[model samples]
Target: MDVLIVGAGPTGLTLGIDLARRGVDALVVERAEALFPGSRGKGIQPRTQEVFEDLGVLDAIRAAGGPYPVRAIWKDGERIGEQPMFEPVEADESAPYTEPLMVPQWRTQEVLYARLVELGGRVAFGHELTGLEQDAEGVSARFADGSAVRARYAVAADGGRSAVRRALGVAMTGETVDPSPFLVADLRMTGLDREYWHTFPRPDGTGLALCPLAGTDDFQLAGKFPEGTEFDLSLDGVRRLVAAYTHLDAEDVTELRWASDFRPRAALADRFRVGRVFLAGDAAHVHSPAGGQGLNTSVQDAYNLGWKLGAVLKDGAPEPLLDTYEEERRPNAAAMLGLSTGVHRGEVQRGKATVQLGLGYPESALSEDRRAAPAGVRAGDRAPDGRVDGVRLFDAFRGPHWTLLGAPAAAAGVHALPAAPKSYGPGVFLVRPDGYVGWAGDSAEGLGAYLARAGVR
Candidate 1:
């Protein structure tokens, strides 16, 4: 294959789909025989949805995952203010796929897998990347089954304990500060009065939460057990924690499913990529599951890099374009890690309307205009989806395209911008394919100069 991707988790699968859509040949190798199950990543952010829309599977995703908003409440023996839930996207903006969806990590993978299949690509389940060796031309990989695979480029989407990262001798350094234990499970509750999730502080570390699946009435609960006590999400642990925390008696409830005693960790990789081998998703980052951003962030990373990789392989994009993957994604991952950590430590409460939606791309090729805002148009920023004057830019997270939105030089590309050049000054603007402004004139009067500056010859 042209590209070899390790680990068919959410990130890897999504990248595989993207590569196929771009007409790039890709093969994904996953260790597991099947995709993940249950509700691991329960929340999805607006940025993630934008990536989905760009993939052209947003409709399927919305059909599979949810149009539901996941909420967080204080467990200090009382409820508090909640984010004022609004429509997925406001009418004034360019971002079409706005709002978070509450779906399990496994289901997200399933949707991505379907997209890949539709695009004529398939994942190699049960085939694992045991080791890897790379040189100038390409990367050679050895699998657990005594098999080898080679490709022009290989992405270590294999996840946090990436075998590929280890083969490259890349070291990760960080503190496992809060190694708290929590019992988690997906069970079919016989019946419940209400349909919302709950988290309360009990005598143990943290009381717990019952996040129900998006469509099904069945519920999944996770709670911190006592330090000295054995932890398990088995039927016994569920009954024990539920009985201890809530007044409802769950003994009559059948124990449908159970997850072994597991402790999710929070940490970050020191570096993301090394040489010809690139790291994406959990292979490049690890963090707490607060806000359920882990899966979402990882999937988005794949979305950002897959197109760039395809562009490099097929369109002869510049080398610097690939470097932007780490430059643009690291900070976003760091931000997500920070927010998730606060939630894990119970340091702060999260609202659905938190500015997580406004997360932007901080890296861009555009030169800085002293008078212009540093992040006026960035690499990782939300690619606004809407209309520019009478022209529609992005229906979703549309990115810069050479095929469209090209102006002579001084015409500025601004979404829903109606101001005329006379009133807006002489500056010219061009919108990127992703619904971001690429070139900007000094002022409305600088239109010709701006076009000249941006090489709009």
Candidate 2:
């Protein structure tokens, strides 16, 4: 196989879809018997929505979720004024998705998994990775069920307590973002309006919040408890907690679907890659669920690595292109880690920074800028979506091939589309498969050489 992705969460399944669409041979393996049943990471950022658009699942995702509702602050069982959960930003052509969408993490994974399968990708469930060994050529992964598979490269999307990362002897260095433990659960309950996210504070300084999960008859319950507090994960416990915190009876919570508890943390792997095996998702960096950056960052990690893997395995690109994955993603993940921690500590608000539209690889070695007079859009910036001449920029860039925008009509060996919008200025821009500008120049003088150096002919 070309790539073996361990863990069938959003990261692995997304990578699977990208690889399948690129016609790369890849397989996703999950240790659990099925998809995760919890709604751990619920917020899908705007940038991730763009990724869904490129992956051909945007309509399904949009149909499966809704915008986050205004948060209704509660005190002593009284309804207070409603405040927006996230800062509002009007959708523009450059950034079509200006707000975060609320969907259960399980639904997101299901959507991604279905897309992967539809693209002719295979997923091996109940296959747990026990050990992994890599040579100069390929990787050999041994599963706990006495099964083994060999692949050109492997990714560890197995999550924060990653067994693959542990086997590779990679260390994760981070501090605890919050010492207070928190509980999250998906429950079926009444006595609450779905129009608002309800919050109930405790006298001890910890609090409980419940948000009606979009496209489902369920509310996700989240609560922070004092240190050393022993929380229950049973239906009775859930009902009791709800009754104690809010103006509802214990019977208000009718059902308990899933429950989990954890202390908030922010950690990044010592390295994203170890030889032929790479770490993505929680395996690469574990973030607090405060700013809703953890899962989105993980999906972007898969997006960043998928194209490079496809380029190397299917496009005859040099192997060194794989090195840029860690080079470009680690620092970004580190910055996101800080952002998540800041949100958890109340130092940052959920605003444009959390939207992640501005995230790019300006300092990446793969980015080439040869413009004598640079303008608004430069190399390493995200190629915004717009209409150019008679073609849509995103429509032109939907496929696996690279796109050359605003270049002369005579430029050879590149998909030279119509000139971009005024936002990008008048220059030749070579958009990478991952939708970032790889090379930008006033003309095609140094464009061909840059593409050749980056293994794009």
Candidate 3:
């Protein structure tokens, strides 16, 4: 196999789809016997929506989810007022997706997994990784059932308690974002309207909220508790907690589907790559889940690494091209960790920062700007969506190949757009497979060298 992915969550499944579409042989393994049965990580930010579009799962995702509802604050069983869940941002031509969508994490995984299988990819359920070893050439992984698989590279997407990360002896440097424990669950309930998120805040600085999960008949119940409290995960415990906090009785909670308790925290892996092993998703970084950055950041990590791996393993790119994964993603992960912590502590609002449309890698070794006067969309920036010369920019960049705009001549494998979008200013742009401009110039003067280095010619 070209790659062994350790986990079948959104991160690993997404990587599997990217690699499979690129014709790279990759396998995803999950310890769980089935997909996770919960509504955790329920927010899908705008940037991730673009990724899903490129992976060809956006329509299914949109069909399976809905937009976030207004928060309805309640005091003493009476509705005080309504507030927006996030700062509203208008959608424009350059940036089409503006707001976050509410899709249960399990549903999101289902969409990604289906797309992976459509691309002829496979995931091995019940394959629990026990040991991992790496050499100069490849990585060897051993499962609990005495089975072994070797691949040219391995990715640790097994989540925050990653067994693969532990095997590689990579440390995570982080701290607790909140000392207080919290409970989150998906359950059917009554006495709450489906149009609004019901929130009940107490005077003691602790409260609970019940939000109707979009595209489902369940409500996601989240409650904050005092430190040192041992909350129960049972249905009865959830009923009692809800009855105590809300106006409804315990019986209002009709059925419990899934429940889990956790303390919000933020942590990042000390390193993303260890020889032939790389860390992606929750295995590499743990977030507080406040600004909905954890799963999105994890998915983007897979996106940033997928093409580079494809370039090296298939296109004969130099090995050093792999090093940019850490140099580009680690710092971005660190910034997201801080943003997540800030949102959890009410230090930052979930507006533009959480949208993540502005993220890019301007300082990476692969990014080249030959233009003397760079403006608007420059190298290392995300290529915006627009229509140029009667061709949609996103449509031109939808495949597992590079895109060159404002270039008349065509390279062998690169997609060339004769005209640049008005929003892109006057310059030639080479958009990477991951949709970031890798090189920019006044003309196509230095485009050949950049494409050669990226192994795109």
Q: Which ten residues in a row have the lowest lDDT in candidate 1?
A: 396-405
Query: Best by lDDT, which number?
Result: 3
Q: In order, what is each prediction's RMSD in angstroms? A: 4.9, 1.3, 0.9
Question: What order do you get sorting by lDDT, best first?
Answer: 3, 2, 1
TM-score for each predicted model, relative to the true structure: 0.82, 0.98, 0.99
lDDT of 3 at 350: 94
List model 1 lDDT by residue over 1-457, tens digit each: 6799998888888888788877888899888888776666666677677667777777777776665543445444455534333334453454444556767666677788888898899888888777789888888999889989989888988877888888888776545635566666777765443345555555546667666677555566766665555764567667766766765566834765646345656666666767678888877778766556788788768876786787678766565667767776777787778777777776755554332556656455432232254333332334455454555544522432321232332333223243322322333344443333444444444444433443332
lDDT of 3 by residue, 1-457 (tens): 9999999999999999999998999999999999999999999999999998999999999999999999999998899999998998889988889999999999999999999999999999999999999888899999989999999999999999999999989999999988889999999998889999999988876889999999999999988887788887898999999988989999999999999999998999999999999999999999998899999999999999999999998898888899999999999999999999999889999989899999999999988999889988988899999998777788889989888888864577688888788899889998999999999999899788887888775
Candidate 3 or 2, higher TM-score: 3
Most accurate candidate by TM-score:
3
lDDT scores for all predictions?
0.64, 0.90, 0.92
lDDT of 2 by residue, 286-327 (tens): 999998999999999999999999988887778998999999
Q: Cα lDDT for residue 22, model 2?
A: 88
Model 2 ranges with Cα > 4 A deviation: 408-413
User: For model 3, what is the C-alpha lDDT against the true structure?
Assistant: 0.92
